[model samples]
Target: MKKITVLAGDGIGPEIMASAIAVLQATASNYEQNFQFNNQLFGGAGIEASGRALPEATLQACYDADAILLGAIGGAIGSPWEKAKQTPEQGLLALRKALNLFANIRPICVPDALLPLSPVKEAIVKGTDFIVVRELTSGIYFGEPRQLQETKAYDTCRYTETEIARIAHKAFQLAQTRRKKVTSVDKANVLATSKLWRKVVTDVAKDYPDCTLEHQLVDSCAMRIVQQPTDFDVIVTENLFGDILSDEASVLPGTLGVLPSASHSENGVSLYEPIHGSAPDIAGKNCANPASMILSAALMLRQSFQEEKMAQSIEDAVFAVMNEGVVTPDLGGNAKTDEFTAAVIKKMQS
Candidate 1:
């Protein structure tokens, strides 16, 4: 039996996660796979229950489980926790650190059905499928020597050779399994940290002779992403760059509501989340899109449990549903959250 931790966070989290759990349960039964789920609290909900965003019990649950499926986190509703107190976001960072989940993967693809919805031309957006491999644990996000000077604010942008090498290794390995091409994004023209990033990634490329590697200044890469998104196979970059780029790349699919993310550690602990945030404005409305959450569950199956076929099944079902024009309002469809989710689950079971 595979044990998984379920953290249904604030806002529309619980509602969407309920649908995912139903699908997972149905899939497990249909496929004859034994699966166990443990519910735990994290984020603002955790803060209310335990006075901490990431309670010891939740961390322990994550450590004990094979993988984690998180809905969304954070909301101004009924929470006095300040950002400086290591709020909901910190819980995510701490969990990533605790699990050594150094690699963050966000795959952005233009589903054919949604091509008309994309801001870019139909021809340019038709077949764009690429993955962004973001180094989660290091880079400027966790860089030391950061402090506020009396007159100026300062934060370091540091990357050790080892840090770059590890994430580079993962990117290369992924490239081998993917399109055999890797684009290392950095600002080598300006920042010293990016200089190191370019240098280390270049050196690491030598080991993957089967993979083709290129370096792009972060600025140019951003432009090319919109202009020629299909040209990219896999993009690897630092935390801050990835955070920005991933959000930008999400538009290729025509709906941020359909994107999913996975954070994986070396020891097999993984966290799956939708690329979209908690849309408090639409909370409890039964109209928020659930595709991203469902896709995140697919990622959990693939990365954490090593159930590739099951993961693919879920993904294939999603594509089938979308192709049939059954999607949520955000994708220009009339289906409610439950209706859309039910369509995906029906396709999964069939």
Candidate 2:
């Protein structure tokens, strides 16, 4: 049995988590796979349980699991978590640090049925199926030698050749499984870190000579993503630029409620979750969309377990269900979360 540590976080998290789990169970039965679901509290629930967003026991379970499925994290302002020594978000950062999670993958695939709802034109985003591989553990986000003061405030942006190379290799390897093209986005013309990023990535590209590599200025690359969404296959960049670019790319999918993300470490363990936040106001409403969480579970199967057929089955069921006008409130449909989940499972089982 594949051990999956499940973190049903705050707000709409638990509800969507239930949906994802139901879909996963259905997929397991259909594929004849055994998944051991390990439930754990997180975010605000964790705070309530042990005054911490990631309890000791929860982290241990995650360490021992095959892959992790997380719904979402964080709590609303004025919650007790805000008053804690470490906020719920801090726990996430700590977990990332502890696990040595160095890569963040966000695939911005626009379904054909949702192109009309996307900000990009149907002509542009109709076939958009690209993934962003963002370096999570290094670069500006974790760089130090900085200070914040009344007059002088500065944060250093740094990167090592190894940091740039490993993430580049990851993108290239992913591209080998996709369209075999990688657009390395950077401000190499201006930033010192990006100069090294470009240099190191260019060197790494030689290792995978079968994959095509092109360096794009972050500015023009951002513009191109909007102008020509399909021109991209895989995008690799440092932390700060990628954080912005991935969020920018997320718009191609229409609603954030349908986007899934994964964070990978050197270890085989990875964590999958939706890119959307905790809709605290909608907690327990039974109207929150669960497609993103369910798709995230599919990503877990594909990325962590290499269960391509099972993963694609879940993804196809989601696309089919959505195209049938069966989405939840986030997609402008009135169907309850369970209704949408049931539709996906029914589609999967059939």
Candidate 3:
């Protein structure tokens, strides 16, 4: 049996998580896959209950689980939760570090049916599908010597050859499965870290002869993402660049509410979460979209459980619902969170 730790964090987290869990149950039952989901407190909920953002029990639970499925965390602005000594985001970062999750995979694909909903012209967003393989748990986000001083504040962006190679292999391997193209995004034009990144990735690319590798400066890459998103197959970059670019790429799907992310370590429990944060404004309203979270569960199935058939079932069910114009308020539909989830579950059952 697969032990999956479920963290229904805060705000619309619980509502969306409830929908995703229902879908998981349906999928598990249909496939006869043994799954034991253990719900736990995290983020603001953990803080409220146990006086810590990531309680010790929650950490231990995650350590023992085969994989983790997380709803969004972090409270809204002006709330006491945001002003706490240890923020919800700290908890999330801690969890990532604890698990040693190094590769963050975020896939962005815009279906033709949702073209009208996209801000970009229909032609531009048409056939746009790509994955960003970001080197998580490293780079400036975790670099040392970070300090705020009287005259200036500074952060370090560091990467060793090993860090660059492992993620490069992941990007190249993923590219071989896709369009056989990998675009390594770096600020090599300006940063020492980027130079090492470019060199290391180039060396790694030699191993995969079938895959083509190209390097792009982060600025042009950001522009090209909006200008020609379809041109990219897989983008591998450092933590800071990936974080920004992935958020930029989220717009291509017509809504941030539909983007899912997966972070995996070489040896440890992996994490699945939506790129979107807790929508405190819409908490308990039953109007938040659950697609991202549901898709996140599908990612867990594919990456952690290696249950491809069940994962595809979930994906196809979600696609069928979206194509039929059944979605939550965020998707320009009036269907509530549970209503939209039920529609997906019905498709899965059918």
Best-performing candidate as measured by TM-score: 3
Residue range 1-350, candidate 3, lDDT tens digits: 89999999998899989989999988787788888999999999988887778988999999999989999898888878876666798888888988898999999989776787788888899999999998988899889989989999999888999999999999998998889999999999899999999999999999999999999999999999999999999999999899899989888877878889999998889999988899988898999999999999999999998899999999888888888998777778898988999999999998
Stronger candidate by lDDT (2 vs 3) = 3
User: Largest lDDT belongs to which candidate?
Assistant: 3
- lDDT of each residue in 214-258, candidate 1, tens digit only: 999888899999999999999999999998898898778877788
Candidate 1 — worst ten consecutive residues by lDDT sum? 76-85
lDDT of each: 0.86, 0.87, 0.90
How many clashes in candidate 3?
0
**What would the TM-score be for candidate 2 when compared with the true structure?**
0.93
Candidate 2: regions farther than 4 A off: 77-79, 146-154
Q: In model 3, what is the error at residue 315, expressed in angstroms?
A: 0.8
lDDT of 3: 0.90
What value of lDDT does candidate 1 attain over all alpha carbons? 0.86
Error of 3 at 172 (Å): 0.8
lDDT (Cα, 0-100) at 230 in candidate 2: 92
Ranking by lDDT: 3, 2, 1
Ranking under TM-score, best-scoring first? Answer: 3, 1, 2
